[model samples]
Target: MAHITIYTTLLCPYCHMATNLLRKKNAPFEEIDVTARADLREAMRAKAAGRNTVPQIFIGDEHVGGWDDLFALETTGRLDAKLTPRSD
Candidate 1:
């Protein structure tokens, strides 16, 4: 399976929802709580192109954006494709 990583905040509703969807899909992910880690906040911003919002998601180096983007991918049926393990 592709590795999932989400930079999240402790009390963000979108963060909770994003994680929930991943769980429902039975996907294992690395949840990095950036609520308290200012260090991580800067790192997340750099990678996310200044998107300093909660729940910045990445699927094996592919940026999936925030919760809404996640839902869009799921609705369009492309999320499963992104989650599948690549032969590389």
Candidate 2:
């Protein structure tokens, strides 16, 4: 499986929703809490292309945006492909 990383805040509902979906799919992910860490938040912003949102997800170095984007991928049947490890 491709490595998953998600930057999130403590009280963000979207973050919870995103994580719930990942859990349902049995996808292991590294969750970075940027609630009280300015440095980490800055790093998240930099990696997310200036998106200061609570949840910024990355799947194997590919920026997957926020919860809506991730859910879209799931609904469209593309998320599994992204999560699967590439033979190459």
The best candidate by TM-score is 2
Tens digits of per-residue lDDT for model 1, 9-45: 9899999999999999999999999988999999999
Q: Estimate, for each residue in 1-88, the C-alpha lDDT of model 2 and write its tens digit.
A: 8999999999999999999999999999999999999999999999999999979999998999999999999999999999996798
RMSD (CA, Å), each prediction: 1.1, 0.8
Q: Which residues of candidate 2, in runs, are more than 4 Å off?
A: none
Off by over 4 Å in 1: 86-88
Report model 2's TM-score to 2 decimal places.
Answer: 0.96
Worst 10-residue lDDT window, candidate 1:
79-88
Listed per model in order, the count of residue pairs whose N, CA or C atoms clash below 3 Å is 0, 0
Total clashing pairs in model 2:
0
Estimate the overall C-alpha local distance difference test score of candidate 1: 0.94
